[model samples]
Target: MTLPLEEDSRPPYLQAAEVLRTEILVGDLAPGSRLPSARLLQARFGVSSSTVQNALRVL
Candidate 1:
């Protein structure tokens, strides 16, 4: 069997963050509602905490 693939391949945390932020801007996510917790996104996108923080910093 092939070795396991490494994650963090494309900086998805940043990408995901941008997407979520845009969604909020376009009223997709909406405001006041609690944003997806880092753990949720980390699990969903297989991204690291720092990467997520970087993306949020942009928001």
Candidate 2:
């Protein structure tokens, strides 16, 4: 769940969303399971609170 953000043209939120989306698609995150807290995600991905929120919005 600790995925480092890659340095690229994509936005940080999009990158975070992509990781989460992959986890969901691959069954790493089962449906109906509660997602990690925003704070936890921020720490995991080294992103800000808003970035985490935006990522969740994408999902």
Query: 1-59, model 1: which lDDT tens digit per residue?
Result: 11122543545555776677777999978689888887776666566777667777777
Residue 32 C-alpha lDDT in model 1:
90
For candidate 1, the 10 contiguous residues with the lowest summed lDDT are 1-10
Residue pairs that clash (backbone atoms under 3 angstroms), model 1? none
Return the clash pairs for model 2, or none.
none
lDDT tens readout by residue for model 2, 2-49? 444455668889889999899899999999999989999999898889
lDDT of each: 0.67, 0.87
Give the local distance difference test score of model 2. Answer: 0.87
Clashes of 2: 0
